[model samples]
Target: MNFSSDAAILYWSGSNINLNFKGSEISAILKDSDTANYYNVIIDDSIVSKIQLNTSKQTYLLASGLSYKKHKLQLFKRTEWDKGTTSFYGFETNEKTKTLPKSKSKKKKIEFYGDSITCGYGNEVQNGKDSGTGHFENNYLTYAALTARHFDSQYSCIAKSGIGIMVSWFPKIMPEVYDLINPNDPNSKWDFKKYTPDVVVINLLQNDSWIVNLPKNEEFIKKFGNQKPTEDFIIKSYENFVKSIRAKYPNTYIICALGNMDITKEGSKWPSYVSKAVVNLNDNKIYTHFFMYKNTPGHPKVNEQAAMADSLIAFINEKIKW
Candidate 1:
């Protein structure tokens, strides 16, 4: 059967499905046939459970131990497209089920832009080694998601593994595809008007620091028209990118953040560059923050992500008061 025909797709990290039912148990017919993926089963907007999606399982019980009354269920795909796509055939409830309209999201909304750290790459791995697989990824526990959930706000995560502000591990950089609906598809375009966040957080520059010093290929040079990337060049590129985002979101608060990686190290010079870019932009609404953290191997674990989230949440609370 063509599974995609009848089912709603949870294609990327942060994609989700919601339902309201009057039942004690709720289950979903889900399939993530290739790579490992994860889902956040949120019931009644309070109780949350992390479920692992695998090829062997066709039906996943999202919530079983619930009181027999009207309740709300939200299933969030906590893994990126690289982890694989999940198809939700439908929901199964012991009693009568009612389809819920996609409720209007919270009045407050936030969007995050970055790389592996924002994507929660390898965050679930117990070992520190970069295993280079989807099994270790769990975007649900990332700092970005944690902060949004803490505020009971809506969120969008436009992040991927090894992506940078100016240079990515792959061919595309954040600037080139930030407007795309599908992070992996070059032809896709996202309409910024569909949902505007009250605040925008930019946590890039990690990969640029690592890749800028290296020799560039002919294609890379042609795309950027810069063979030797200097500190000034990086700052200017970043400032321009922020301007582009501002063009789309004129009044939104923009926070340029760095670290939870080596970007905080004095020698890295990344934090300085980010600060300089925001200063050069000269927008009082745009701010810069540096996270003092160790450059852990692979990615940050849950506890580490929570620490990052706490710091961010504290700042947003102070600055935006939301």
Candidate 2:
């Protein structure tokens, strides 16, 4: 996050700006790189509305007609980095109402490094046509976010739509962008000590399964020229990525997760690959948890995402000391 000129830049999915104030209404000064970005206006702990951003800087009406009492407001970014960045200026309150400091954050912290599943892509879709505007993506409704809310843990997400461990829909994989403070800036480094998570969940490999199969795909060709990565190569790549994360958070529990996609399907080998990587590490702290395949077209919907959160919570309860 870059806080300059009395404003901050929210560049990734799930990033937010929270304010507590006593007023009947409140508005925010904001700007978006893309005019079509989305944001969830959460009052207190419940989401009240989903607002779209404009390309130019302006004051956006967040909430109105509330009791003239203290209220908590959280503006959560719903889209990922590729959706665009948001610049937040400040909030405006009616009358003599003043802004108050937010409540203390939870001591338990969890960091998620995943893909579209964690970004809640296609979550808002109903019957057919599994695609929509960026409004369809809501990070707050994802299994990752639900899991964090359940544990009352501070959430840190670094996820993109088509990212994977071995290969992505794009040339940049998780290993290359995991440590950057800004996803698009290779020179930017995230200070590990700034926020050390007690638990790190890595949900990936769904994209790799498809992309690696198409060895001639642009993404595959860019990541691995001419040759398709063998099973051994895939397993090794997953291991190396986890090891790099372990090097950063030595004592933190690392959950090497796969997905509710074809990656974890009945006959799929991605689960075995993740299990193999965990066995190779031989570290008691690192564990494997794979969500069952949804067996439907497109991404997992909200209910499916909820099921995943429930499964993950159950796994965490049984395996870890959380």
Q: Please, what is the TM-score per model?
A: 0.88, 0.97
Q: After superposition, how far is residue 24 of candidate 1 from its true place, in Å?
A: 1.2
Per-residue lDDT tens digits of candidate 2, residues 82-151? 8878888888766767888878988999999999999888888887347646978888989999999999
Model 1 misplacement above 4 A = 1-5, 45-58, 98-104, 216-226
How do the residues 22-84 of candidate 1 rate in per-residue lDDT, one tens digit apiece?
Answer: 777888887776657777888987646778876754777887767777888888776776676
Among these predictions, the greatest TM-score belongs to 2
- Model 2, residue 271: what's the lDDT? 92
Q: RMSD to native for every prediction?
A: 3.2, 1.2
Error of 1 at 287 (Å): 0.6
Worst 10 residues of 1 by lDDT: 1-10
Instruction: Tell me the lDDT of model 1 at 201.
Output: 94
